[model samples]
Target: MKISEIVTILDGVLVAGKDQMDREISFGFASDLMSDVLTLETNDLVLLTGLCNIQSIRTAEMSDIPCIIFVRRKKVTPEMIELAEESEITLIECNYSMFKTVVTLAEHGIRPLF
Candidate 1:
């Protein structure tokens, strides 16, 4: 699914990488643990998490995750946004909890990493 579709589905705000909104994403993984995110091996992955920190952006960069959705209305810092922009990662913010974010994505045809 396209990032635009995901934004619509999750009612998210595109906080960075607006140009990447048309990018296609095939799989999604939800986790707050950076260790778990580091173990993921997939292409075109969208990471859904509540960890709104520079570390999250770094983990996504290291894992080659193209997009990240910050759930539960987490505050994404300017440092995080700057890092994401530099890393070419798309950042989105949503009011839904992580569970709801995952469920909404699944219901909209976004598959899990497994």
Candidate 2:
């Protein structure tokens, strides 16, 4: 699915990387644990998490994740956004909980990373 479609599905706000809206995302990984995120081999994946820290952005950077969706209306810091921008990662904010976000993505044919 495209990042634009995911944003529409989740009623998300694109906080950064507007140019990457057309990027393809094949899998979704929902987690708050940076350790778990670091364990994955992510490519063309969108990370769905409530964690709004810079660490989350770093994890996405290390994992090569192209996009991240912050769930439950979590607030991302300016520093986090700056880091994500530097890494070329798209950041989105959604009002849904992590569970709802995952379900919505699945219904849209976006599979789990596992």
Candidate 3:
């Protein structure tokens, strides 16, 4: 699915990387742990996380995650957005809990990493 469609489905707001809204994402990896996020080796994956911080952005950069959906209504700070922008990672903010976000995306044909 496209990032734009995911934003609509999750009732999320695009906080950054508006140009990437058309990016295609096929896998959903939900995690609040940056360490766990670093273990992924896949393409076209979106990181669903509630840990809204610079670490999250750094981890995504290292893991090559193109998009990040902040769950549980967590807010992304300006610093986080700056780093995400530097890494060219799309940032999305949503109110859904992690589980609900995962279920919703899965229903929309986003495959799980496992």
> What TM-score do all the candidates reach, one by one?
0.97, 0.96, 0.97
> What's model 3's overall lDDT?
0.92
In terms of lDDT, the best-performing candidate is 3
- Candidate 2 lDDT, tens digit per residue, 9-101? 899999988889999999988889989988887587899899899999999988899999999989888999899889999999999989999
* C-alpha lDDT of all candidate models, in order: 0.91, 0.91, 0.92
Mark the 10 consecutive residues where model 1 has the least summed lDDT: 36-45
Off by over 4 Å in 3: none
Candidate 1: residue pairs that collide: none
**Candidate 3 TM-score to native:** 0.97
User: Model 1, range 1-114, lDDT digits (tens) per residue?
Assistant: 999999998999999888888999989999999999998879588999998889999998998899999999998889998999998899999999999999999998899878
- List model 3 lDDT by residue over 46-104, tens digit each: 99998988999999999889999999999999999988888889999999999999999
Point out where model 1 deviates above 4 Å: none
For model 1, how many clashes?
0
Better of 1 and 2 by lDDT: 1
Q: Candidate 3 clashing pairs? A: none
Error of 2 at 73 (Å): 1.0
